[model samples]
Target: MNFFKKLFGKKTGSSNGANQGRANFSGVYSTEHFNERYNEFSLEKDMLDGCLKMIEGYFIDNQIERIIEGPVNHPANLDQVDQSGFGFVLYCQAFELSEGEATMFLAFAFSDYLITKYGFKLYKDQKPDHPLRGMTLKYDKDGVVLSLYPFEYTVKVLKGNETFSALEEKLKANLKELPKVDELLKNFGIGGDK
Candidate 1:
């Protein structure tokens, strides 16, 4: 009788294992990976809307002369291009005043805008940790230029008639007056400085 009972128990256990099979494997896999995928899906729409709204707001507040939507005409070599995935570009005058200073100012403004607007967390792995790792900034006798790609971000400063050296000097001299500039930008809601 005991042998029969034992044999029946063994049979039941094997049957259970066979029934479970791949069905049990489902819960064992992680759900965390799905979080990122879902988050990215949701963020795509949100980011695009946010970018358009921000651009419109900038134009209205700053009273900029012209504000064009979508891909507009730009000089091939003049302005910087930041290719954040949401389809946006920040076009401005490069060194309208030095190449180095214009480059520096653009970097600062872009970085500030990213952090404030998108809640982009900066990684502390580097001295100035932002998603902007491996970014490039270059200056020539003509002017300063930079380009960012891959749905990350970019800033293009257009060069006018000013020489790169003159623009650099102007940026350096204006450093002390940045606070006032900051206040002006704040008024325009550029970086949320207010």
Candidate 2:
């Protein structure tokens, strides 16, 4: 038998044919669906890691106290993208912006890094009025807050959410747990003091 045919031909319920059953069910999920889900998951993971690295670099570089507590919250389905073939809309929030300068610099640095590193085009030039291009700094009864929206449509960092701080802290404490994120940070010159 030809190699192709032998490899995919009849299964004889043997040790080597264990995957044959899975092959039979492959048609149950279309290849496109599989690819979409996989891609969405990958994008979300990358985005989360990217955010962490950006914050870490900002903290280290500026000598600011690290407020990140845990892994970013995973992307969730949103109404706008629910039926748009997009899998999910992820949101992250960082807080305790008492260090205003560092927070502003970090947000801009992260935006620049995203554009240069990932080719994520900003909707417009960085300006206060630029819809997807500006940083918002606010002061409330509690403290200062900075909200950063890096991606035009998919990702955002909010303020005033309690869970956000907790998540950030968890991420910082468990930095070693996410190897892939660490690799990305190292590649981007984030983890090192330089």
Q: Pick the candidate with the highest TM-score.
A: 1
- The deviation in Å at residue 180 for candidate 2 is 30
**Per-prediction CA RMSD (Å):** 26.5, 20.7
lDDT of 1: 0.28
The sequence of per-residue lDDT tens digits that candidate 1 reaches over residues 78-108 is: 1222222222223223214243333443343
Alpha-carbon error at 110 in model 2, in Å? 1.4
Give the per-residue lDDT digits (tens) of candidate 2, residues 1-194: 00001111245556875543221110122345433422211134465465446444443444543232322121211111222221112211233333333233334434444334323333322333345334322111111111224322222332322222332343233322322433434554657554
TM-score of 2: 0.21
The global C-alpha lDDT for each of the candidates, from Candidate 1 onward, is 0.28, 0.30
In model 2, state the lDDT of residue 72: 19
Question: Which ranges of candidate 1 are over 4 A from the true structure?
Answer: 1-43, 67-194
